[model samples]
Target chain A: MPQTGRSGCPINLTLEQLGDRWSLIVIRDVMFGNRRSYGELLAQSEEGIASNILADRLKRLTASGLLTRRPDPKHRQKGIYSLTEAAIQLVPLLAHMGAWGRRHTRSSKELSVRAELLEKGGAPLWNAFMDELRHLHLGAPRPARSVFGELQAAYEKALARRARYAQD
Target chain B: MPQTGRSGCPINLTLEQLGDRWSLIVIRDVMFGNRRSYGELLAQSEEGIASNILADRLKRLTASGLLTRRPDPKHRQKGIYSLTEAAIQLVPLLAHMGAWGRRHTRSSKELSVRAELLEKGGAPLWNAFMDELRHLHLGAPRPARSVFGELQAAYEKALARRARYAQD
Candidate 1:
């Protein structure tokens, strides 16, 4: 179909698109921290992806429909990047990767907490989490019963706490 | 710990080592097929990984203890690469990645068959598959019973079929 991959295997094709080192880190920032601006993503990434590489990956990911870049209503020079439905669906993959890492590698206590929460919540939680984002920004259908209500509340609380610290 | 990774998150550390485009592909070739030599690996990889990049990745993987390379007993010019226990443990991750690909992307029919086999076999099957390699090359302990009897049997049958075809 598309001429973007070396093999016809879907997994290989997807890996060809998303398997690079920087792309997932960018996606991780978008999915976890609500960090979409270039500066926010670049700052949060521990890997120190080059600015050129970051720009290239952002362009490619957007072209692939995994991310969307829209004009920031609040800022003129900045663009807000958001995950698309296809990208949001990757939460399971990301969660599994994180879980595997937690099991096999040395991880931080705070990181493990997030991984455990995601694991305990399972696919339904991820689905509802995505639905919440859609409801907030994309006007998509809402979850049947606000399944992630408490988790989202907790997340918001944490964000507010961080914002308060930033003020100081 | 060694100063190689960006974060204490185990996944990040593992990704630091294995997150590149070529590392997993190299591991996959060693695990699934009988590819061991530099020439064989290069031949099997359709994506045309740069020779320098391939050399670098192989060295890094070996340094990380995921693979071991030695002189080919029968061929002095070639080196025989074998998977270590760490690499074998990656079967689950690889299987999951393949399954994810099969579920989401367009893939090759032949490759999908292999992925389905891995999926149906589950983790124990993956363990047994690794044990088979260990027994064959590494002198590692064998399973109490024929844990991967079916898979081993299938491999033999396929080998025989290939021999017959080659003779014809």
Candidate 2:
């Protein structure tokens, strides 16, 4: 399909396809948070994504081939959203973005934990995480290394640290 | 200053700062296209940015610390804009973004040449380019290698190829 974006510069095209305030956020949820259902995305939204905006972004992302929606087998009426290969490939970009934010923005310790790990771990970590995502979302064989576990463990540690600090 | 964005997730924070449609485009022009002044940016806008939007984004980017503006020595009435360390560091993210678009989106060959080279050259090229940007925008000493020359040459070659293809 022809890109109807403002320009054909690859960055502009990428932005045209996915530059909204919430599109990447939704993909982040799918890729990292493992939130698949519309309800889960809305309820678990750390950014407090409004339901209408979430619904619209879901539709747009699905149309743009970043996501695919299928009927939740357990509930025929509910749909599970999965990231497409396009969105799956966004790991490095997301890593860099997170790294920039960690350095520049004011973020909660628990939230910045993932960005810190991703930056420190670099490409090997990003690739391993991508492999694990392929296993989870694309049904690829599970990789022996679970970078996801590593990242999640770090985040949990930060959360525990915050709890202790709070009690103090 | 505290982040006014919805959440502190690094990705979300980065997006909150730079996620708008035109913010990065303006930066791209300044970084890659060498369009610094308001006139240069407005006149060379690839996406044909509206005058008001360009004006607004320039102010926002300047206010957000991604860009700095100063009265032009040549023309005191017109201000020259330069990228800050924060914006200069966006090279990797922009590179990944462009690479993804080249793989996934429909783009004109000429405009995508830089993205193609960036993907092929990888981090080394990005670092060289960032060094070049620092020299140009931040008054750093010029680097030994000029990835900008390589990227611009590739784009020119592609533009000529497109012209020849059209003539055929």
Candidate 3:
């Protein structure tokens, strides 16, 4: 059984753990591919989260078992962040949120592209995405490569497009 | 076309509008039972949202097109709050959130029961619930008596259970 802290509502508890504005963005960055260091998250976020708040949210997220941090293998000074199993379970929630937002909010080309893919992919896409991450990061059994090759390709394409705009 | 106020990412915009802790709770109260009167909201909520903040949220929600407020027919000083189409759309989101929380968090019996019902009923239940509200507030056609009857039974059961443990 999961632990109940104070409130009895599940949504309230989830909010207590991951409701802040910055936390989900951080998770998004990590899930999407920006997991190298804190600086990357700070620079890439659209919300312009403050440095202190970002740092605090990262620490809280780590402590809450949503994410884990390790010293960067390439650079001792940098911290490499990765999602735990608990955090990966959030893919469905994130996908739904993204789809909802896409339906209601003004669409950016990039956001709409991502949302469209997420909508089509649904739970299978989310599960496959999680499986790939687990295989890559934690040495879990490699899922059938065919399952995620297209997703990986699309994600890479998105990343390249982002890089061009990011440099300009 | 949906208007994106900021970036194209639907999740970010949604977060900007409905991500706050209190906003969803306020919406839940209005959708579930709490209708008009500021005092009733304050009295019922266990979170004890600050009056100024609650007032501000209510105003913002109304301005944002999620809720509507009208002069209460019974009490001139009171404003009867009703959910707009946009707010009604959030029933599924809230239901999903509640379901996720129940699966992952330790919650009270009352909340757990509600979550279980929501999970079992899914979108159909959400639609039925919203249709009932529309009829009550907007004079839409009434739904099947059985549908309303089941919803009322569940809602009343939850309320009574909550009252047993109500704090002063």
Residues B15-84 of candidate 2: C-alpha lDDT, one tens digit per residue = 8888877788899999889888999899888999899989988898899899999999988999999999
Error of 2 at A165 (Å): 1.4
- Give the lDDT of residue A46 in candidate 2: 93
Each predicted complex: what DockQ? 0.41, 0.88, 0.52
Candidate number achieving the greatest TM-score relative to the actual structure: 2
Best candidate according to DockQ: 2
TM-score per model over all chains:
0.73, 0.96, 0.82
Scored against the true structure, residue A40 in model 1 reaches a CA lDDT of 83
Residues A1-168 of candidate 3 have per-residue lDDT tens digits of 122354676766777666656677778768764454799888877767789988987888888788888998788888888888877777777777777777766756565566668679866777788897787556689888543456456756877898898999
Task: Give TM-scores of chain A for all candidates.
Answer: 0.79, 0.96, 0.81
Best by lDDT: 2
Please give the lDDT score at residue A60 for candidate 3: 84
Winner on DockQ between 1 and 3 is 3
Q: What is the C-alpha lDDT profile of model 3 across B1-168, one tens digit per residue?
A: 122354556777888787766788788777664455677887776566689988988888888888888988888888878888777777667777777777766766665666678779866787788787777657789887444467557767987977876853
How do the residues A30-113 of candidate 2 rate in per-residue lDDT, one tens digit apiece? 888889999999999998999999999999899989889999999999999988888889999999999999877886779988
lDDT of 1 by residue, A20-101 (tens): 7667778877777678789987887766767888888888888988888898888878888888877776776676677667
Native-to-model Cα distance after best TM-score fit, residue A95 in candidate 2, in Å: 0.4
